[model samples]
Target: MDVSFLGGPHPQRGVGVVAPFDFALDRELWRWVPAEVSLHLTRTPFVPVEVSLDLARLVSEHETLGDAVRALNAVAPEVVAYACTSGSFVGGVAGEKAMREAMTRAGALPSLTTSGALLDALTELGARRIALVTPYTVSVTQSLEEYLAEAGITVTDRAFMGLTRHIWKVPYRDVADMARRAARGHADALFIS
Candidate 1:
């Protein structure tokens, strides 16, 4: 008698990521994911409309998210996560809930958004006061601040780059400096949004 063994990926051990068209930190996420798990990422359509409420509104549309989620659902991920912070918060708290629910329905699994994840992290850490740092313009940064405020987080200090384009082009050194400056004020933690 002869016997053979077949090996393949384990069930319910992979993660699905839905990113915005302009996202550039996929490598970072990949580097951090545990080797035992697989990462499946999909990008939603984006027009690169400067980082602002307008940009947020455009990217957070349910129609676009539905298409993106449908595409990711083909892989049958155990959990789906939306990786765009602005897109997740642009619609406010209710909008974030709706987006997560839509992804859950389309991907047929539990879903998470960047804003939701951030809030969870903050809550877990008991950090209600935050210093915000971002490469977005004042208007865009303000919108994010408002979203956090709705969640009961206070923005004690902030630093903005006021750049409307090429946020990914920013250097890491500059980002570090911005974060330091933003955290100068008394706060529980610094949030680089």
Candidate 2:
């Protein structure tokens, strides 16, 4: 009956995550995290707008990010990650950098955005050309393409769903089909946004 030998819970390091209000991939995010680390996630304020360039801009405003980062600071995460793909890329590279800087200024922690991480991964893999798949309208998808291009990566092919809302509900079969369509051309990688 003596279970005291188990001791208290292990100390956990945390990564603060600022996700869009509609984000539904918390489990997916946790899958990549190590057992010893924890994710402290916060969402941007909900807005009436559906998923679009305007919505992306709204959710990722500097003031919004700063507020989210400050809230996460209470948990003392070692680093912060802005987890919206569209919001991060809609502003392009410069915007991504500014978002990180703003989060750092608010929380005094290292910060990164999803678009920045994507670029870093591409560079690490030496993937100069890629095929893109997104559940965004043409305009939003084009913004992502422009963002990638600014990072010197070419989009060799692409497929989009033209979706405005509930992107998390997209069926895996449909996504697979879209990926298949996008990957038909020569590409160093396939990026699903």
Give the winner by TM-score: 2
Cα error, residue 61 of model 1, in Å, equals 1.1
Looking at model 1, the pairs that clash are none
The model with the greatest lDDT is 2
Q: What's the lDDT for candidate 2?
A: 0.94
Q: What are the runs in model 2 whose C-alpha is more than 4 Å off?
A: 1-6
State residue 55's C-alpha deviation in candidate 1, in Å: 1.7
lDDT tens digits, residue span 74-158, model 2: 9999999999999999888999999999999999989999999999999999999999999999999999999999999999999
How many collisions per candidate? Answer: 0, 0
